[model samples]
Target: MSTTTPPTHPQRAGLHRILIVGGGAGGLELATRLANTVGRRGLSEVTLVDRYPTHFWKPLLHEAASGHRDPASHHIEYAALARRHGFHFVQGELEALDRSECLATVGPILDLNGNDVLPRRLLRYDSLVLAVGSVTNFFNVPGAERYALPLENVKHAEEFRQKLLTACIRANHLREAGAALPEPTVNINVIGAGATGVELSAALRNAINLLSTYRLNSLEPERDVRVRLIEGGPRILPALDQRVSAQTHARLAGLHVDVLTATPVSEVRADSIVTVTGTELASDITVWAAGVAGPPLLKALDGVELNRQGQVLVDKTLQTLSDPRIFAFGDCAACPSSIVGVFLPPRAQVAHQQAVYLSQSFLRRLTGKRVDRFTFRDAGTVVSLGRAGALYQGDFGLGLRSLIVGGRAASGLYAFVYRRHLFALAGLTRMAIETVSQWLRARIRPSIKLH
Candidate 1:
């Protein structure tokens, strides 16, 4: 490890550096769009600063963790994207913000191969946007941080994929070797019934099916591989409309995933989750896909107004409640949503929509024109339950009541959501490249990693 002094990008005396701290869906779009205009126009410069050098869509992280998808086949290199979009990409964590001095210090960058890439840096900005996303909230449960894995980013998802496949392989090995491992069921307890949890429970089951077909025929029956989707809410998909939630419930049940609602986990142990009902959920793999909370650094940012969950509070204009120069959006920021009568739920669609709005708004500011407040159009919701099927609710245009479709059609639509995003980011040509690459990977790679 190497530690150096502070490094700050020099800002022109009058021009503002449009620094964006997070490179998630919203932040990346905002920075790229702004760079295309203000950065190239020389009216302002756009710099996207992220903890990671590459950005993978957060929604697909679940699929990656379940081995249903691969990260290498679907990641955007931040440096390359910045260059392509006319911005600078900086890799560092958000350490602290000196709002008084208009300066923020970013945490050091370290390479994966044991070398210091860059040290803490102080970046001064005239206008700053914090698109930092949220993290899995364990809610202070005992052994949760110690044992349960969280699916936060590409790195976290990639690591959890190994844990999942390892559990499957170890259970099969112990059975064949005639040694009973502690929890012989290969049980997996998935906390939270939100989109990620609901989707992953189904994906894990589907992966086991593929594993048996191509690699581990000995583990013939997947019912033996127990998957319990535990949720604290009254039902899964609590954020979506009630009808959509009901549809998702039936589809998950058809997949034979144990859907446990109204069941809150009290503690996560070495190989199980203790429920409020006093029953121990025997799980060799414990995944916390539960609720989300903002990062700790957001709370520490020099008196910025934040909600109880620690997300930055922004008005309709996407500017923070307290700060004038700082704008916010995405999982880390609470922007007003007319449909919910409160802050909009942090969905990738909402973030992407807000980025489009903010980019135009910021451009207007650069040209000394008036900016408009953002208005989110609720485009309905869709959730896929692996091979079992999908649940979708949304309007199809023409002011008609949005139709909700399920089973195969919903599954296809559910998948199209991510595809639509890639099309926007990489266009048709790059998407074709990604498609061909994953198909080849699927052929050569094991149906499952088998640990």
Candidate 2:
């Protein structure tokens, strides 16, 4: 194994080094935009470091989990993206930080067989940005970590998809063998009424319908497959308006999803979920999408001040409270909101806007100009309901009420949000090309991944 200390890249010696950790929606966009401006003019050397070699949008992980979207087709390699956008890509996890020395220690990269692929290295940076994102917050529920699957990344999504497929196939074989079967041969319980849980439950129902029609003709989707959504709150989407929540619940009913509000999970077993009310629900697959908190790495960030949720605390300028040279944003940072004592919500739009704002702030810094405070404009929320439809509530600025939209038009708006993210990373020409390619591929390939 090899060890290296600082000076990781061979760039211009006098240029300022900007190191960004994490390649989520916000980090990648900031890297691309900054590379086009400051990095292009040789004012600073930009480098993006991520544990994964590829990036997949976190918002769409639910679709991947339900097999509605293929992970491989949508994944963007960091190396290729770096070459196109004029930035450097480093694949490593940030393990330690030294605020006094302005240095970060990255852990070693290992292969599947536990062999070393890359040695531990140190990266020196003039400015560091942390966007490492969040992880599932189990809240200390008994057996949740061991039994419930969390849709935090691509691997978890794919694992859930495969297990779902296996459960369906196994049930079909049991029926063929003339064995006595229980009601709802396959039971899937998703604990959470948030956007991820709601969207995933709908997607799973749709996938099951398609599978019964196309492949598992012997199995009846409605009679044999059950999808249950459990929420501790009084209603689903507790964060949104009451009208929006009511509309979404009705739409879910149309898709035959069982929504259990005010039902808190007490324990998760390998084959069952126990609620706080002492009700035991038999579950073939259990998904935890209830909540998220900052990753454990944030706790180790060299005296960085974090909130109760383990998210780094940042001021209006998005810089960490402990050090000005270090910054945080997206799901990892608890950025102050316009409302007193409230942090911004963890949404893709919020991150996208923050990325744009940070890029401009960096450019202004070089000119010795003042950096303005970051403000987030409410852009509304959109929820996907598979092929049935979607619900969208638009936030009208000022004192005007929000606009509620439903059906196909709402679905189109949902698609546009993802395309807009792509446009930020790649220019319009490439984004358009990617759009056309996905359209073509959908026509040729199976709707769901068989494997």
Candidate maximizing TM-score: 2
Stretches of candidate 2 off by over 4 Å are none
> What CA RMSD would candidate 1 show?
2.7
Model 1 residue 177 lDDT? 77
Tens digits of lDDT, candidate 1, 1-451: 5454654656666777788999988888788778877878888888889998888988887788878776776779999887777788888898888888888888887778856788777787889999999988888999998899999987888788877677677666666777744543688888999999998988888888877677665564354588889989899888777778787787778777889999988999997889988898787888998889899888778879999888999999989988889988999998877655587887988998888898888889989999887988767688877667778888545676557777787777777777777666666798778767777988998755454
TM-score of 1: 0.92
* Residue-level lDDT for 319 in candidate 1: 94
Give the top-scoring candidate (lDDT): 2
Model 2, position 327, has a per-residue lDDT of 95
Q: Supply candidate 2's per-residue lDDT for 94.
A: 95
Error of 1 at 384 (Å): 1.3
lDDT of every predicted structure (CA atoms): 0.82, 0.92
Error of 2 at 62 (Å): 0.9
